[model samples]
Target chain A: MHAIKTLSLSILLGCFSLPALAEDPADADPWEGFNRAVFSFNDTLDRYALKPAAKSYKAITPDIIETGVSNFFGNLSDVGSMLNNVLQLKGGAAGQDFGRIMFNSTVGLGGIIDVATPMGLPEHNEDFGQTLGYWGMETGPYLVLPLLGPSNIRDGLGLIPDSMVDPVAEVDPIRTRNQLYGLRIIDTRAGLLAAEELLTGDRYTAMRDAYLQRREFLVNDGKVASFDQDQF
Target chain B: MKKSIIALAVAGALTAPMVAQADATLYGSLRIKAQKLEGTSHDNLNVTDNSSRIGIKGSSELFNGATAFFQFEQAVSTDTGAWNGGRLGNLGVKGDFGTAIFGRIWTPYYSFTGAPTDILDNATSASSTYVINAHRASDVIAYVSPDMGGLTLAAAVLPTDKGAADDETLDIKHVAANYAMGGFTAGVSYLGFPAADVDVMSAALSYTAGDFYVATRYENRDAGVNGPTEEDAYEVAGSYTMGNTTLLANFINDDDNVDDVISVEVQQKLGKQARAFAAIIDSNVADGGDGFEVGYRVDF
Candidate 1:
């Protein structure tokens, strides 16, 4: 309950900074101060509580079970991605994601196994944030949310609408839903454990820039954008 | 479509037997360049096939937790449409005990000294002219230790027979060790021809982060014969990738009458499998030699 209150408070604070993000500067980060504070809070929480839990999860879970859990979550994400592809009007990608979902859900035994990839139905990663960007939304100031983590204005807004389309969000039995959500978070964090060794420089800024760059790349779909003439 | 079908048929026929035995992969690269060389005496222009090669490599699991692998690579002259001589041929067995291989292979010394800094497509890289023992040797046997915490040691020997009346002698010996950690690598290599009275030693270090990669190499050579000729060479190279283009540059100083060379190259990626590149090489020797080349390369 306390964690939920903190999460809601962070969202409220993040929303208050959106206006400043709109009117402020041309740089990628306009809410550096507030974002830094949130980043510190998130980092402290990760270092103390979340990291330990993820470590324990990794140590206790067998490899095959962990892989099955990851595959199940991945199938769930693909379902959301197919909807996002429709919203973005990417017909070809939507067809591919649709094919993936069909094959994986059936042959893969409720997404516990991944037999589709070897059959050459490659994964397509689409999200509501990418959909917003495809519709000509400029990624606003980099913001760090409390429990949700790094995001921008458009992507943060995207979460609200996108969550409604997610089947997991509609699950009955509040305890089960909460447990699933918690497991997802823990699984994701545990997956990133090996990557922590590569961190260098200022952790907060490095992570922020990497996140923003990756988001930009995904939004552009591996294409370089021409320079905006007005910037000259 | 007809030509592609014939080509595919030919390739399939050639690889059919290998495929049945192991996981054979038919891979090749086609690199053709239009080159111009300028010297103090004359200028020249020619189209050259820059180490274009096709190879088949495969590996299969052996009994007792070991794996057996073999590779046969042959150079092809794209300009003349002719198959050149073999580039590499070797068979090996690898397991936790490490790898043991025999036949034509690159000496560990060549890989340790040259691999890090030679980023260009063709002859422009200073290593071609500056480094003496950069070429591969035939009749070779090599052993490589399994990686121990990112550190690996390798040793190779090239044995040659002088004539029918004489026994085989190990003419060349090479030993190298490399350590790699998080996009950073450091290596040292030594090459010795005891019968020929020549020795070469080199050390190299490289680091890669984000869009930039940089490397430096230092080498010393002692040709004990011919009035005790001794020389040293130093090279520094770097490359930066920005979007679809990668810019590369290298400088080498061979300590023989202050001879030096500098090369710059730019490669633009056409797609996933093809790239077009241009390079210029300038040498500061007294004779004044330089070259310019434009090339396109495709890998399959």
Candidate 2:
């Protein structure tokens, strides 16, 4: 029954991703399942906590690590190209340009900064699970993968190729590895970082739900799913 | 050639029924952490490391040998309780002859030493310590060579899209070769960045045993086209895996001449997805005793 529930959810989520299913996205945006619950919690935090605290703390507030992390991923544009080979995506025309730019910026500069596009190569979007989907693998079940957050069986397995090509994960020194991950959470818990003191609601539930919905939006390329439509 | 490439992608897409493979699986890890380190050199004092995020990558094949691939990853942090990370978002694409992408991409000159650290694994003083990070360059593009045996070459170019005569005119390029047979693996890479025209060569060798993989590497560099010359670099590391448990340990040396460094790190993976890590780092030079760091991390 649990597996059935997960599968049902996966199908519901999966169906909404098709370019065809988005015809009536107004009623399906921010689909329910795990995402709906997360949206609700994030809304609650914004209403009762984060918004109120922002006015006062904004002045002295430190920025979140997400910026760094996003930069980290943004910096290594070639990772997508490597994965594209394994997944077989539609990027040949641009892959060379993209790969050239990423390789030049990252490795050439000791990864201190990206020198990819400013040079010449164009950017490309690619990954494994998408390759699997393009290859015919079923999405399996919609699962909130414990701490790693949102995922379906298909994407879960997709990690294999991503990890395989990830230059950071491939780095050896504990220093470089740790440094890459060094600023991971401070920014993640930005709202919670300072406001851990002002909570009137269940923080865990609030965080967990918010996390799940965020993943859903991310995984679906910002497209709104069916169940998410009912929410305001 | 491009036609055949698209044909292949389209063929791959055709094999997979649209309904069964509709939405690509979305996966990524969000790491929320804090790190403080004391170091010499550079103006930033008692710098606080900021590294955290959540990203998504997916792809679908077209009937003409083309595959639709993309990724959306942003800094996931608590600023205003919304998706906020100065790094912005990124996307990618790949097919036939090569691949292409957009969004923030890594600069090549900086990517040479992809992994040359000891015990720092993002927990200690070493997390944000590298000298090459320039944040994410926008409107970026890149490419790679199809593997011929263990040899695959790649390169990237960055144009100062800002439309300025004196805008950033730096060019970075790199090529890497890797080989794997049974449990033994080895790799060598080269980098040439002309903005500073620093030519560098990095090599790595390793082997795996019963959940444990050990590696050693060395880097020889000519610091810049005309800047002060720096030191050589070297390191050794090992990762042990048993079931869901993997342990990592390493010792590293970055003899940058100006401010040399020696460090160590030990980390235990609770599972493939999460790890608890710790490290100690120190840098000594003409100035004086430099720095140190210690911490733990959990990724989701």
**Predictions' DockQ, in order:** 0.01, 0.01
- Two-chain complex of model 1, DockQ on C-alpha atoms against the true structure: 0.01
Worst 10 residues of 1 chain A by lDDT: A1-10
lDDT of 1 by residue, A23-140 (tens): 3333878788998899899889989998899899999999898899888877887887889888988655665565456546644676888865664456776678788999999877
Residue B139, candidate 1: C-alpha displacement in angstroms: 1.2
Flag regions of model 2 displaced more than 4 Å.
A1-232, B1-28, B32-50, B77-90, B96-98, B106-113, B116-120, B123-129, B134-139, B160-170, B195-197, B225-227, B243-245, B257-264, B282-300
| Winning model by TM-score | 1
**Which pairs of residues collide in model 1?**
none
lDDT for each residue of candidate 1 in B1-100, tens digit (9 for 90 to 100)? 6999999999999978753468899999999886666766426666778889999999999878899999999999897899998989999999998999
What TM-score results for chain B in every one of the models?
Answer: 0.85, 0.65
Candidate 2 residue-wise lDDT, B1-300, digit = tens: 699999999999998875665355555444433223443442232223335566666787767776667666676543343666545344555666656656566533233334433224543233222433322455556565555565545555555322324434555455556666677666676655655546667776777766567777777667552236754666776655433223355555655534445444434344556643333445544432433332333455
Give lDDT tens digits, candidate 2, residues A1-232.
Answer: 1121222233334423333333443343333366546545655654575445444444455444344343454445356544564356443423343334334433334333444344334444445665676576766654444334345577668767666766666667878776654332222233233434432355333333333343355345456565543433
